[model samples]
Target: MSAALRADPLADDTIAAILAGYGGSQWEAIALVNRLLAQWQSNADVQGWQAPDGTPAPIAAALQAYLAAAATLPAWADAARIERAEELFFDMSMLSCSLLFCASLPECYVVPDLAGVLHVAGQLEAHCDYRVRSTAAMIFPVMMKGGLASPQGGGIAQILKVRLIHATIRHLIVRGNPAQAAGAAVPALDAPCRHLYDTLYNHGWDVPANGLPCNQEELAYTLLTFHYIFLRGLRRLGLGLAPQDEEAYLHAWNVVGHVLGIEDGLLTHDMAQAEASFAALQARGRQSPFLPDPRPALGAALMRAMQDQIPLRLLKPFPVLLTRYLCGDAARIDLALDQRVNLLSRALFGAGMGLARAIDSVVRLALPGFSICRMMTRIVGYQFTVKFLMNQTRPLKLPPALLNQVGHTVRAWGDDPKAPRWMNALEARLAGRKARRAAPGGQPC
Candidate 1:
């Protein structure tokens, strides 16, 4: 690695920004750390609770060791970097959820307040709109339908239409940015966004409904949209998963690829191949197998949640209440369901309630003294995988040198471009490229 690349990206300014994101959230961080540690303690408690008498002692020992490793890693070691990532990711999650929620509302025929909604667009100052638009698209469907309790507002079709509208506005906003450098301008967005607006305005809500008959195709297009978002997020932040965790990262990437119908030959580990590999491992008992069990239950649960027609059933009263309190709106109650059934049935929906119940079950199953850490890790990973897969991000191959430099700079500045180095090199290169084109005179190809 070049010297610049080898330097830690979490230099001074970056650390400051990172520290700021988590400053007031220390209690949460400490609780998380404690929870991770307690998960190990739960394991020891497990031997006494659930483990069979014949189960090997090594299982507990291995888990203990992993927890120890996690705990001993200094909280501040890469504190800023992690916090910055979490901050952006958490914000994006909330924003995307809010956008979908609003779009789901009966009154929001076409989502409005473009300037307010697109404020996060400023986060993409470093990347192009195509990249931004794509990411937004992929995430749109999932976020719209995700973790919801309602059926009518949460269907994939409604989600797609809302996403298309959001994408159209996002494109227009980019094209209309007066501050964008000439070299960085994305003129192509103007036509497409306008075309989509016209389509939606002229034809009403029937465009995507009539156009995309296949659910998988709709899923694929939406996935493509958010792929760009994830890419832009990663790019703008100058972040990459640690190389040591390549397998884990690739697994997450492949999950999204599967949903998108993109064949990358990475995630195609079929049943036969899986069985063959399992047979080759002459390891311990069946329950204690060496291979990590793949998570299919999550996909099933997510699909179920999307098809849920009511929100009150899916989310806890606290979240619903909090959402209303923050937004200054009255909590929406399902009077129709209540009158037919009872008051108790009004607050919860099938899928949201189902997911909450399942999550609780899994957590409890992992409790009584152990496996909570593993469960939490697994849950966090799946959430990330789902989010990542649903993202509109894509891969862009930069010159290795440039990648390293940007990565290093991000590490230092906490991935904020407001710091000095981000635009310095990019501006110089863009200027150089512009000069070369301009030297050839008018309309240089």
Candidate 2:
């Protein structure tokens, strides 16, 4: 883990070798960024440039080699396990979204230094689009049907693009200062906000102190947020997967970790290992807190953005409470979610979590898969789906066709195949929607 803090895959990457020759030219960087983003934000089947990296760059050969390799799936990726994981994802689709907003996202902020980077990058409180875009960019593409293994799938493409984005940010951070190129200690907090990368570069990273912008440890940790934390969140909600399913889910994300340039050692095989590694890494993050405490602002902003979108006056306060519940006391304090919510909300949440689990336990023996926990989460997920994901008004750079696809997919989440008709009806009533397709061309949540 300590070793990972100072490592970045780009240091050994062919792309970085070519980028090195560019001499930190912002024009060259932006041109490349624009070119790649056009492919990334395209509808689908665009993770790699099918053609050469031919935009007048002298290092086209290097770029071609890098893309060809970076975009391919690793040999160790188990197709059967990945397929099982995807099936599990489909079964828990809505709950997955709920975990994303309340669990995975909050956990992502617990690493204070990572939160600092995100705070500077997104300023998510002031601009909610970053939150939505970041979430949508990752979850949708990866979890979609055939997203990872298929060449035409968007998951691999999206993840590869994310890798490029990470590399680009690292480059832009040390753009002018060659001293930072070697991952030497330095800071830059005064760059203008003309571009996202420029702002991130200027946000003042002490490379040696805070590690590289998105070091291997941080990247590995972030990968766990999506898989380990999500799986843990499910267990907390009494929605834990079967032991085999859990392993398969972990395996799938491990494959993703491989593509994201994480070391094999950084990945985990079982829940115990995942828990220990995650805890140790997170403890290291806490021990080395970022100055100015980026966690609180980022946490507050995330909660605010979530609250603003929840139309129910009663449920407005739920985001804070939910984040606290999913993330636990230490993480709650880390994210500044320690403040008290209303007694009513507290009561409702307590009843929702405590009594629901108790009832589900007793009922599960009688009815094979009955779960009050599942029902309540489904209801909450539905609200989040409508408010954040399917809202057509939010500006997105994605194509209308893709937006429509996302909207259709979200609408399909309205149903719970395991739930009986009454449970489904109750969920619909609570979320203020009957099971039906949402209007097409909606924005990705």
Candidate 3:
């Protein structure tokens, strides 16, 4: 094992390797591996799965148990936090697998049971649209209801629309690559992929300018969400990016991040600024329904459940994918992607709220014991490591080297890991310095 994996034994790389060696459904394996980890961590005296010196057994053995438990994981063992964390890991892993795809030729295919894949896609499509529309209904609600309110209520709706556009386009595109992109000899499925990209590129332009009923504060926050989504999607598809396209996307993304009140430091480190800005806007003066701090309550609940003895699942999607997707099966890719969209949507919008309510509910569901602050810390740490340790220690810029690394890692996760890359590569290209030159002046997209 590499020192990186050994030092940070729970590093995404190690976890991914562990998952790959085990044979089980991705989600089931996730649950089992985590459960075993918690068990091992808590008891140094254990053997079998435990090492002779009290450390956990070889990573591969733990992975085997995780896979073995797949057939037997209790139906009643639904830990909400664990499930949520696994879902996020699953999403990141799926993306990583695609980014790491290194084959010069297209991968050959084994036709999967399209029924399960398509069914999941259908359910997710319906779920995402419902959430988007529900949030849409909240815009200018009093006016829509013919009640007493000014025009500004609609601004929240518009911001939500832009976010929904992002969420939808991303999920659709990510779902596209592995199954259809790999197998299709024709363009029928590719049309939706192209359309989704077009939608993201065009619709996102309006978010920063929408005459929402908020001060500069809320507007900046809204813009940041849109911009981050754009950047993130683009960064994932590194190798696929064309030289000409790189600079434009990068410039637009960075400028937008700047305009949305993101300081270079905060953008580089503490990313909660965007979310914080959103909260400030929501709570401009008096209390707003759009704002609440759920961490304390969620933490309390988690403590109660664990009796302060167990480690809950980590919501690190990228690591989990690394473990699961190392083998070259495409079906696993489809399964992971399907689960990711469904889980995010359900967690975000499973509650019956209109679009605005869905947003609020998602925020609520995500934050309960979820620790955005901790997540923010980890994100900053990861970026810093990438910059320094990875010799990417320069100012934020897209590098082909970075892209190549991401592609290889992603392919390790699953079969259809293409959409995230496609979207991300475009974003990365736009993020490149060349794209910046293409524009007469640096401007937000």
Candidate 4:
């Protein structure tokens, strides 16, 4: 085994313990999640659910036990820090959403193995819109509830549900798509992918107990994407957060990572650890033989889906532009978005961001409570989108039937012929602006 593989033997053991103690099997985990959802629907307290014969339901009992242990505030957890992080996060809601969708999600696809798994699972290419919305919905509950410690916090509940989903994916991939799980025919974008393939195939195979689909390393990569990459995107946008706020923000996600089953060794405590881990991972990824493909289609589709949230024709190109700017040139090239940003789009994006920064600076100086205003704006916008635009009620449910309906609706909307005409016109307008800017006197008239 490579030194990297040998260095973290405990991560594998930790994952095994987590799975075994929680529900023993993926199906059992799913059952637990269903029961939890049912309790939610009926407005019954999850901790109070009872099985037939007057005994505690096995799944509920197991999950409640896990939550009781996992959801507690760590000895290092700080309430004041968490409060500061929440304020910082809420104040930058729009930027956060942009980073989550455009930067963080696309970055995940850079790993060819992860990309292949998500693609085969119908989560990435097949139902991209629903995937994005579902992800955002899951995140919303957590952020709004103020981290994962509160008994009233939806984050704990939501993370638990997602944990079950991950387990199910692990089971399906290992059993049904063994070739993919073994990394056959998939490009290796990094040393980690190659290592993962070797571990799955060459190193002995055990199903559901010692071996699973998504392991600790992959989970850690995802956690980094959410916490590290999101912060990087904010910095690119010139949103400077206080050092304390940054550390506190990572602290909140560290707790979230714990509940999500990431091993403590892989979970970062502060920015220094996060940066070191991220750099090490990046170095590993650079050693992969995989050439980037499939990412362009995936990235483009993700940006297109955001048109629903942002209606203006002029603002259409900004998502792609911001993605390129924040994610850097290498990612832009890898994701097939390199050619998408023209001179006009770049100029417009720069001007718009500059204006936004100036406004934010003014708000910070003149109106001390401007963060609250931004938070309220985000809340109102979110409520409108969920309730009116999507015609879905709040506190979103992800039952199978509802998910199917959402996928179908989103696909139908994407297929509509009218969708591209507006986008085409928007592009044309942008091109015209570029042409005018290049004309005599460099004027836009």
Best by TM-score: 2
> Judged by lDDT against the true structure, how good is candidate 1?
0.27
> By TM-score, how accurate is candidate 4?
0.66
| Reference-based TM-score, model 1 | 0.20
Candidate 4 colliding pairs: none
Each prediction's Cα lDDT score?
Answer: 0.27, 0.72, 0.28, 0.53
**What is candidate 3's lDDT per residue for 124-149, written digit by digit as tens?**
23333222223222211211211111
Model 1 residue 418 lDDT score: 21
Best of the two (1, 4) by TM-score: 4
Q: How many clashes does the backbone of model 1 have?
A: 44
Specify the highest-lDDT model's number. Answer: 2
After superposition, the stretches of candidate 3 with alpha carbons farther than 4 Å from their true spots are: 1-127, 130-216, 223-256, 259-278, 285-412, 415-445
Assess every candidate by TM-score.
0.20, 0.90, 0.18, 0.66
Give the alpha carbon lDDT tens digit for every residue of 161-216 in model 1. 23223323322333321112112323222223233333222221111111111122
Using TM-score, rank the candidates from best to worst: 2, 4, 1, 3
TM-score, candidate 3, is 0.18
Q: Sum up the clashes in candidate 2.
A: 2
